[model samples]
Target: MKVLAVSSIGGHWIQLLRLMPAFEDVTVEFMSTKQSFSTMVDGKKFYSIPDGNRWNKYGLVKCFFAILKVVETSKPDIIITTGAAPGLIALFIGKLFSIKTIWVDSIANCEQISMSGKIATKVADVVYTQWGHLEDNKVKFFGNVLG
Candidate 1:
């Protein structure tokens, strides 16, 4: 199975990387904001998309189109993300394309699922919250990197 993992920098990126060993035998590709971020991700294919975040509305729009292009070319069978916003955009596209999607809300949001995670519940095949207390009918809690 081909899995495309997408996440922003900082904690989101770190958590996504920790999930790598789990995808060992599968074809995995990565998408992020910077080439420097690609340094931690060795061997696998990495596509550096435009840098964007919640405050950068313009950048997010550009990144959205860039993500669309990547989705078209890479044609990932599944998409997973530890998100902020960019990852959410990719999940939306992945859903529209009929690609399976997973949204792992950041461990930082221990009390509640992030806004993006709440939105993902409608589209993603699965939504995971690292905090066990947050688990419900839609979100699953299956431990985390911190554990």
Candidate 2:
């Protein structure tokens, strides 16, 4: 399977990296907001998209198009993200291409799901919350990336 793994910088990126073992048998590509992160992938395919958030509309638009371009070019069979906004945009683009998408909510959101994660529950094929108490019919609890 060709997997496109995406996330923003910081905690999201850390969680995404933690899930790398799961993609050992598959072809995986990495996407993030920072170009410097490409080196961390050990020569694997890497893409960089502009970072964006709810507070930045223009940035979000740029991020959306950037993600769209990556999705079109990578043609991944599955797109997975430990998200903020860039990853969310990738998930939306993945759906448009009929690619399977998975969203693993950040481990930092212990009190509640991040806004992007909540939206991902509707856009992604599968949505996982780190907190067991947050699981429901749509959001699932499958062990967190942190532990």
Q: Name the candidate that leads on TM-score.
A: 2
Error of 2 at 98 (Å): 0.6
Assess the local accuracy of residue 58 in candidate 1 as a C-alpha lDDT between 0 and 100: 93
Clashing pairs in 2: none
Minimal lDDT window, size 10, model 2: 66-75
The lDDT of model 1 is 0.92
lDDT of each residue in 1-147, candidate 2, tens digit only: 899999999999999999999999999999999999998998799998888898999999999999998888879999999998988889899999999999999988988988998899889999999999999999999998888
Name the runs in model 1 displaced over 4 angstroms.
none
Candidate 2 root-mean-square deviation in Å? 0.8
| Candidate 1 accuracy as TM-score | 0.96
Q: After superposition, how far is residue 41 of candidate 1 from its true place, in Å?
A: 1.3
